[model samples]
Target: MRNYLIAGIAMAATFATTPAFAKDVIVQMKNQGAAGAMVFEPAFIQAMPGDTVKFVPTDKSHSAQTIAAMLPAGVAPVIGKPNQEMSIKVDKPGIYGIECKPHTSMGMVALIQVGKGPSANLGAARTVKLPPLAAKRMTPLLAKAR
Candidate 1:
């Protein structure tokens, strides 16, 4: 019984010292009728693994989706429907590219950086194709990490 009690205390200590709990980050997809006005607020975000990202559409006609080609090899794809709240749990450490399908041409894209250090597949992520404006907008955002 004494051994079991000690083991219980050790386990409890382990949990207590660990990084608390996961958090949720919100991303808003805003729509503006004017060309180039539709975009994602805070186009770049840094998060930890196991965090949740909730994509909210703050205006008419917008959707958030993962850019498949830009995701880490093993990560799952996410595609959010218009005007609906979509939540995604991030379990990988890497950069994730998000886009608003209808507005991608107008630079409606975002990026999420999870965890620390570097991900194994960053090379693959850079290969993703984006619209002219999207690519232009992401250039500085991506460079900020370096």
Candidate 2:
């Protein structure tokens, strides 16, 4: 009986930790040095609710911030500075637009599509139109391959 109880407890622990090990996608925000504006690689990412998304900075003076009212309540990310990383565990099914505060006007915005419902296209289907300035700066960055 003692051995059986121990085995059961172990199994329970494993089950409890299984969900926490789900795969995470690491997205990068490129700083572009001084040639151009920073840009998020892929420009858009698709993730399931509960999945973790890590934003890594690839240049200096760059940061990630979720535009107010762009994400559902409780889904906003905690903004951080360059070289620093920020993570968000998407818990709701919807589209989110994230940008670098100072660069948004220069097209430093990207999209995050969470959960499986409706369209999943990050740009064409659920476009988060950016300001002309922001879009212009992002043009060059978007052309480079990851």
Candidate 3:
């Protein structure tokens, strides 16, 4: 009985120390959504650090990737192949700019905010020049950032 109790306590401790609090937020890539054609179903996402953002390709010929100029300092870029599902684990608190490479000119872009606090890189990300259509689409999404 004592051995069983010790093992149960050990298991509880291990579970408590693990990163089980992280959750996955799914964003679907759609050819046509409420926003229009070639867009992520939810163009704006709010998540916490360590949370995973899963980009599901619900439509063909679409991809999800981070924009170079929109990343937080020291964070590596995350990119997905066209028509493939991709997941990004947001490890930092900031605004991450995502785009469908082929459709960016037509405004296929989205923004993910990792934390609730104001992001230090928000201003810079907003200023990163995008195609005319992407710029117009990003304006409202950026405004949704904390």
Number of the top lDDT candidate = 3
* TM-scores, all models, native as reference: 0.83, 0.64, 0.87
**Model 3 lDDT tens row, 13-106:** 9886565888999999999999899999799999888899999999899999999899888889998998999899998899999999999999
Global fold similarity of model 1 (TM-score):
0.83
lDDT of 2 at 78: 60
The C-alpha lDDT values of all candidates are 0.80, 0.65, 0.92
Give the lDDT of residue 141 in candidate 3: 92
Candidate 1 residue 41 Cα shift, in angstroms, is 1.2
Best of the candidates, TM-score? 3
- In the range 1-146, model 1's lDDT, one tens digit per residue, is 99999999999998865556778899878875333488777788888887899888888788899998877768899988877887878888888888888888989988888877475656666667788999898776676542
Q: Worst lDDT window (10 residues) for model 1?
A: 31-40
Candidates by lDDT, descending order: 3, 1, 2
Winner by TM-score between candidate 2 and candidate 1? 1
Regions of candidate 1 where Cα sits further than 4 Å from its true position: 1-20, 32-36
Model 1 root-mean-square deviation: 3.4
lDDT of 1 at 29: 80
- Candidate 3 has what TM-score? 0.87
